[model samples]
Target: MFNRIARFIPVLQWGRTYDRTAFSNDMIAALIVTIMLIPQSLAYAMLAGLPPEAGIYASIVPIILYAIFGTSRSLAVGPVAVVSLLTVSALAEVAEQGTAGYGVAALTLAFLSGAFLALTGILRLGFLANFLSHPVIAGFITASGILIAASQLKHILGIGAHGHTLPELLSSLASHLSDINGPTLVIGVAATAFLFWVRKGLKPLLKRLGAGATLADVATKAGPVFAVVATTLAVWVLNLDDLGVRIVGEVPQGLPPFTLPSLSMDLIRALWLPAVLISVIGFVESVSVAQTLAARKRQRIDPNQELIGLGAANLGAAFSGGFPVTGGFSRSVVNFDAGAETPAAGAFTALGLMLAAVALTPLVYYLPNATLAATIIVAVLGLVDLTILRKTWAYSRSDFMAVATTIALTLAFGVEIGVASGVVLSVALHLYKTSRPHVAEVGLVPGTQHFRNIHRHAVETVPEIVTLRVDQSLFFVNARFLEDLLQDRIRPGTDVKHVILMFSAVNEVDYSALESLEAINLRLKDMGIGLHLSEVKGPVMDRLKTSHLADALNGRIFLSQYDAWRALSRGGPSTDAA
Candidate 1:
């Protein structure tokens, strides 16, 4: 009982073994992650159309909650770029940005998302995330990266532009060209270029300057902090806000406050679908990062418990003046690379963020929005991989089509529609391929018991016996196809008296397939032919025995195709016994 309970509350399993060494390691990792998270939290909040402080609040309570419930030792849960975009997309539909209603809608979205994830976890439906194929997911993320970068460009240019799709955003940006602030553009461009260089060149430059490898890495990870401080100082000294350069303005300094998500039916009905989308996308992204980090240390991640962890984190966000958040790829990688020994590092990081929230809010008063936009641009650019198109195209055209369609739709429409279309396309592609399963006509190989595709190998076949190997599971969607293929293979005057289905590859037979089989058996019987089954899987055979099909089968069920061949071939057993 205790072990079963511990699976749901992972902190219980790790807490008892906590030690001084673990504490020391976690504190160091916490300090590094805290420094890195501050600016990102602010930037991602801007991305979500929420106030800067919401980001800090999100990073605090949610990280603590996730550490208590999550299984991964290094996953850093907080506001991420894609989920921020999704939050804006979902809430922008129902409420005007920057309105009280908008914030309420965000809270409601977090609540709905949390409830949805928790319910799914309880139901053990983590496998549903797999319905969105890897190609589709890759396409969605790539397109979303492009969209997020485009969305942040207005801030870089010091102009007002708003849209969810590429065409709209581009048109909006074009119309605002005359209003760009020169100073803001300089800060944005220089900050963006600096951050990009820091990502790729800073560590090597530091190492060449005689810094140790670890120090170089730590400095590189703090690049955003450097950008934030420099821009804030420049803005403060020059009074850039008077020159039409936007700043973060005033952010509240204190711990996250107690709050509640709206429970009104009207808000719930409007936000539920978006909430579900956010939950799935967030869960998939979080679990992917967690599993990857866990694999490096030869650890395991329980997906269902991860759902609960993320769910609790979101619920914590909902009640703590925040919005939907998830495990971030960059921060989690930093936490792992910084030598975090357990999830307790995340909790300590939360404490550090809480201290910042209490005392550091005043320092960002003059922080230019352009600098934050630069931060977002550099962060999301890493997610865009156009090479996926080339790779998928070279491998499978069908997969390429799914990926291409997802990217195109996401760019043309919005995130929700893009993801929905990807899901539909993935399912459709799967059905199309499975509905026309590969049915190979087989014959006995010379001097061997094995059967081979007659068209591909030199094999012996009797004039009166026909055998086919079904290469896919028998399910409702493809049941009729099997019936039609079998009908097409057997001609009226080919002297076919015995038909055998090689079942080595068929792992399942659904109700529709069983009915199809019965219909085939009756049809063949009326034509004075016997239908036999060979090498049926044990579970399938058990299911068949429960139905009347086994008793009504026109021919014997052989343990192997070779047994059927030996019994039915020339100078063998009689037809009825065989």
Candidate 2:
């Protein structure tokens, strides 16, 4: 019972081994991630069409909850660019942005997403995330990054624009070109260029300036804070606000307030699909990051437990006056690089963010929205990797199709449709491939137990015997294909009396496939040909034992393909063969 309970609450497992060394490592990681997440949280909240303070609120309680329940030592739970874009898209259909209803809907989205994740965890349905193929995911994220950067351009130009799709956003920006504020444009352009430089050049320059590697790395990571401070000072001192430079204004001071997501059926109905999409996408992204980081440390992550952890975190956000949150890729990488030893680092980071909410909210009052927009642009720009198109195209055309379709649909229609289309295409592609599984004819290599494909190798074959290798598991989807293939192979005057199936590659044989096999057996028996099975897997053999097909089989089940070859080549059963 204790072990099972600990599986659900991973903190119990790791806490038992906690030490001062762990605490020290976690504290250092927490400080770095906290510094990075402050501006990120605010920017993401703005992107989601919420108040800047809501982002900080999201970072606080959600991190604490994820620390308690999540399995990844370094995954930082908070508002991420893609999830925020999705949140805005989902809520836009139900409420206008920056209204009370919008804020309430954001909370409700978090609530519904949390509930869905928790339910999936409890039901052990975490494998459902596999429906979104890696290529499709990459495509969706790349398109979303492009969309996020384009959407933030309005803030940089100090103009009004709103849209979920790329074309819509571009069209809106085009119409508002004359409304761009000059001061905001200057701030936005300068900040964006500086951030790009900081990301690519600052670390090397700091090292050249005689700073140690650790100090240089930390300083480079803190570049956004530098931008925020410098830009805020410029706005305050130069009276840029008077020149129509939009500042963050007043962010609420204090810890996140306890709140409830509205429980209206109409609201639930409107947001449920989007909520589910957010939940799946968030879970996929979080698990991918967690698994990658854990692998580097020679650790393992339970996907179902991760679902529970993320579900708990989002529920915390919903009740704490914030929006939907997920494991952010950049922040998690920072935490890992900063030496996070356990999820405890996330908790400490939460504490640091809470203190910022209480004391540092005032400091951002003069921080221009252009600077925040610049931060978003720089961060998300890293996600736009068009090289995936070339890579996937070189690897597999079907994968390229899935990736291309996902990117195009996401850019043309919107996130919801793009992701939905990706899921459909992924499933469809998988079925299309598996339904026509590779079937090869094999014969024995001279003086060895090995078998090779007849067309590809110089091998000896018995004139009366036909050996076939099925390369995939037998299921309803490809059962008829197998039957037709066997019929074609054993055509009119083939001089074959024995048909041997090499089951070495087959992992499963479902009911429909079993029936197909039975039909094949009956047809072969009528043709005076014996149907034999060789090297059947233990579980498949066990399953066959429960079916009538095993009793009605026309020939013996051999322990090895060589054993079948020896016996069948002699045209009778061998007594030496068990």
Candidate 3:
């Protein structure tokens, strides 16, 4: 009972092992991550079309909740770029931005997502994430990165623009070009260029300047903080806000506010699908990061437990005056690299954020929105990898089609459409491929028990016997295909007297497929041809034993293809098999 309870509350297990060394390491890592997350939390909230404080609120309670329930030791939970983009997309459909309705809808979305995720975890349905193929996910993320960057261009240019799709954003930006503010544009461009340089060159330069590796890494992670400070100071000292430089003015202070999401059925019905999608995407991304980090330290990450953790975090967000959030890849990697020892690092990070909320809210009033836009642009651009298209294209045509369609649709339409299409496309492609499984004709190699495809290798075969290798499991979708294939191959032949099906690759035989197999056996028996099966897997054999097909088979089942060959050949003359 305790173990079961501890699974739901992971802190109980890891807490016993916590020592001074772990505490010290976690505190240092938390301090560094907290420094990085402050500006990030504020920027992502803006990206989600929420007040800057919403982002801070998201990072605080979510991090603490995940620390108590999450299984990963290093994963940092907060408002991530992709989830933020998804949040804004989902929220825009329900209410206008910067309104009470918008805030309520955001909370409701987070609540619904949390409930769904927690229920899924309780049901141990983590395998459902497999339905979203990696190729499609890669495509969606790549497209989302492009969309996020484009969406932020308005703030970068100091103009009013709003759109969810690439064309809409470009058109909006084009229409507003005449109203671009010069000082805002200057800060945006400079901050963007500097951030790019810091990401690529600063670590190497700092290392060369006699800084230790840890110092260089810490300094590199502080790049955005430096940008925020410099830009905010510049705006404050030079009074750029008066000259049309937009600022993140008058952010609320203190910790996250207590609130409640709406319970309207209409609102729930409207937001459920989007909430489900967000939960699935967030879960997949978080598990991936957790697994990757855990592998480095030989730790374990329970996916179902991760769902519970994330669900708890989102539930925290829903009641804390924030939007949807998840484990951020960049922040988690920073946490891991900074020598975090347990989820306690995240708790400490939450404490740091709480302190910032109390003491640091006034400092960012002069922080230019252009700088935040620049920060978002630099951060999300890292997620845009167009090479996935080329890579998928070169690997599998079907995968290429799914990925290409996802990217194209995401760019032309919005994120919701793009992800929905990607899921449908992936499933369609899987069914298409599975419905036409490969069945190869085989012949025995001259001097061994091995069998090879007749067309590919020089092999020996008897004129009266034919052997086929089934390459896929038999199921309802492809059962008819397999039946038709066998019937077509065994035409009113002149010399074929025996047929053997090599079941080496057949892992399943559903009822529909079993019926098809029975029909095939009866037909073969009527044609005066013996039918046989060889090398069936254990579980498949067990399933078949429950049916009458084995007893009604026209010919005996053999343990191996070679055993069938030896029994049926009767020392027949061998020739080149075609």
Per-candidate Cα lDDT values, in order, are 0.93, 0.93, 0.92
Q: After superposing candidate 2 on the true structure, give the runs of residues whose Cα lies further than 4 Å from its correct spot.
A: 572-578
| Collision count of model 3 | 0
| Candidate 3 structure lDDT | 0.92
* Candidate 1: clashing residue pairs, number: 0
- How far out, in Å, is residue 449 in model 1? 2.0
Q: Which regions in candidate 3 have their CA more than 4 angstroms from the true location?
A: 571-578
Model 2: per-residue Cα lDDT over 377-428, one tens digit each: 9999999999999999999999999999999999999999987887898889
lDDT tens readout by residue for model 3, 59-79: 989899999999999999999
Spell out the clash pairs found in candidate 3: none
Per candidate, the number of residue pairs that clash is: 0, 0, 0
